[model samples]
Target chain A: MYVQEPIAILDSGVGGLTVVKEVMRQLPREKIIYFGDTARAPYGPRPAEEVHRFTSEIVHYLIQYRPKMLVIACNTATAVALEDIRSCVSIPVVGVIHPGARAANGRTQTGIIGVIGTEGTIRSGAYEQALKQLSSSNEVISLACPRFVPLVEKGNFRSEETYETVRESLESLKQRQLDTLILGCTHYPFLADTISEVMGKGITLISSADETAREISTILYDRNRMASNNELPVHHFFCSGEPGMFKSIAQQWLGEQIDLTPVVWQVPNIV
Target chain B: MYVQEPIAILDSGVGGLTVVKEVMRQLPREKIIYFGDTARAPYGPRPAEEVHRFTSEIVHYLIQYRPKMLVIACNTATAVALEDIRSCVSIPVVGVIHPGARAANGRTQTGIIGVIGTEGTIRSGAYEQALKQLSSSNEVISLACPRFVPLVEKGNFRSEETYETVRESLESLKQRQLDTLILGCTHYPFLADTISEVMGKGITLISSADETAREISTILYDRNRMASNNELPVHHFFCSGEPGMFKSIAQQWLGEQIDLTPVVWQVPNIV
Candidate 1:
């Protein structure tokens, strides 16, 4: 029997933990290696070249684990550097964007789709192209929610002013009469209640994390990447920043504590 | 007189652009330096240390451009690294968490508030702490909507399935019987419609982006960071990923056209 290798997941920071959560829920038997570049995060605002350099370095770092597959849990890195990372690593590199686009395409009624994401993902037009390529008749309206991830990370999910902000940001899109909306960034799912409230009853909200998780399952199944049932799968986490903060947050998000270790990466030389 | 300097707005990615749009609408005279780290994107799932590092990098990068004031448009970065970045930089740093928490605390009639966000932010208890700190009588129930960011980023803002996702994710929070919900993540604003539908109109939704913008304006005015009437405020965008992709989606989100430029940074050495 072939020995099952772990799945390697990388993000600029802890945002990718959402992806890890889904992976754990859906594929509990598979081991995981999660790497967060805590020392340098919020990859959305940097230059593409810098993002690419950062993504490559992280992927290179994760490669040492020799996981069976790779998940780029970050939308920005997926948008700017997924292809580059794929080329650099021998493992299959899966990103959240394509799976998300595919999921959105699968479920549109009026064909008018709305997307919200970080400045990088929305600006990349990767989803637009993917949706357009998938179906020409579909109309995709994208909004760059540059603050959403930050807001979510800050723990301001339910606030009166947050609703007003939602109203203001989405007022135009609501007017567009879109039937479906995509949560382009991984961090957005946390605001599902507020988003649903603003968009009204009829509009649909699609989560890229769910779609990406489903896609990962499908891909792994097709590639026979499932782990053997000989022992419990080991999930390991490494952050470029403080291990204590990462561990605390990871426990809360995952609802169960896992081992989180700190690994410093030489950011200066990687770029 | 000092030359007019642009307003600097930064997020992990596109979510902060929502704040930029608001700032533009509320104050058209201001030039804006909007940076979306399309490269690293979505700080929601990463560790606090990494989020802090990424936040500092962007803040430092934005400072190089000499903006009048800085708006930390992301809640996650604001919660984890705002103070650190503020200390490192000379310019005034504005984060969305406190203003948003204040807004929620002020609007709750039942004194029962529900806060949701990415795992890291929710775990940090920033909003909950801020809300409770403001009013001990208020009860805050915090949950992490891990899937929302990716869904919004992928452009699936409203759909029947998305509604189902919203319903499933928020089922527990709804049981808490809270009157106010904070759109903790800037991206949650995009999902406001669906969320409102699930929670009903009786529940008020708040967004940190709008509140943060107000706070930013107030700070700019208080600190005399407001730009002078000189030349048309130049709006510049820098992405760590693809400029073309960023521009197209940005146009959709901002409801206008923007010129996005790509920059490359050495990632390996920095982190």
Candidate 2:
């Protein structure tokens, strides 16, 4: 019965919508204020400090709305900026890595797990460390599916090119005999069916989007900050790049008509 | 890498073992320091303020060890005291409700969900509110199986009386046509088989303990607070009440020999 404030969710591009979809599925009544820094496109290839700066800047834009929570929906951004953003705001903030790692631990019976993400997420070894911390006995295999985000951004999840790239990237993991594979990158869930096909039905694919949405639900409930059930929710969308393409893809994925507002970045001087 | 510090976990009674069991399974290298306030067992019926005080006192006691994080493993304690404890400490603090709600949200498809918990949890309407916030369209039915807790405390989860109590309490929920049920109380997972039998295979059950453990894994990973993998983890257990019963039940549930430490509660003066 608390006041309903919009939750601000940001990602480098469309990858975070996988998270937004899950959040909407899990928390329908709560309004969402989403910003996709599509102008920056892929944060994966960018330096950690650059990702942090972009994340911080987007967060500053989001703060104007006074959101109740902030979700760093992009995996690369999350790896570099999650803690920094938590320090930036008093409201609850969450990212994707921990959720994916936790779900992978739960699903794997073979004690063998695999993680696939961008170069940064894989290179950072965040998933490997998290999996190891959870159970040192777990055999964690990580591979950077660097081609994945771009494929998803293009909305080519099931294309033949995607299949070849996915199969080639995951070919190494199949040899490891992993029973569970984590789509460490948020965008990867959009590629789940193809990934599942390549890995086969025997291997469980863990989506950070699903787990992150659940984590958000948990924190909101713990803080006595759940939105009231009385009103209909209005969701706001923004992207720094071409609104037409972003809107088209978002509508295709969301299965609804949406108004995507364009946001121009005002780079703030950092001390 | 951060220095390996014990992760502090607290519950009203032995129920937290479910979470500890998970933490141990997921994070094998991390040491655990567990405290079951068996002397002040069953936080379900207590007032929020009183529960908060007791939780704060226990947290103060646990903080002496300089734990790397705090896990509020009990649902009642978590619902009332999680945020306060987070405010009281600098180490990352986590709780059970959001995790439970998130898991249930993920599991439920019919939009009709059921929550069974202590009177305090049900009366607080935390689960119902959380579910609704996730999706206002969700029809959430909550029931207080107050009798279920005492049965669990006595380790009578599979007995006929426990079945009868579970059946009687959940009979109303069955009539509501729910596709998923959340074992909102940490003690309730112990009653899972009986509860499942009563609800039948049609409804999936969500365990707060499992979800909470996953959340803990997520937080530790995000902070880079993961314990080193090379060292063997040493787990310590404590109780303010009778250690014998607590130890026996814990050993049976964990399927491992554990050393149970007894601590005398020095009631701190609270303003």
Question: If you score just chain A, what TM-score does every candidate get?
Answer: 0.92, 0.95
Error of 2 at B100 (Å): 1.3
Candidate 1 stretches greater than 4 Å from native: A1-3, A268-271, B1-271
TM-score of every prediction relative to native:
0.49, 0.80
lDDT by residue for model 1 (A195-233), tens: 999899998788877667656654453243555554567
lDDT for each residue of candidate 2 in A131-175, tens digit (9 for 90 to 100) = 776677788888888888888888887877988998898887888
Worst 10 residues of 2 chain B by lDDT: B262-271
TM-score of 1: 0.49
Residue A179 in model 1: shift from native, Å? 1.3
RMSD of each: 23.9, 5.0
How do the residues B150-237 of candidate 1 rate in per-residue lDDT, one tens digit apiece? 7766667778878898999999987788999998887787787888898888898888776666555444432435555634466888
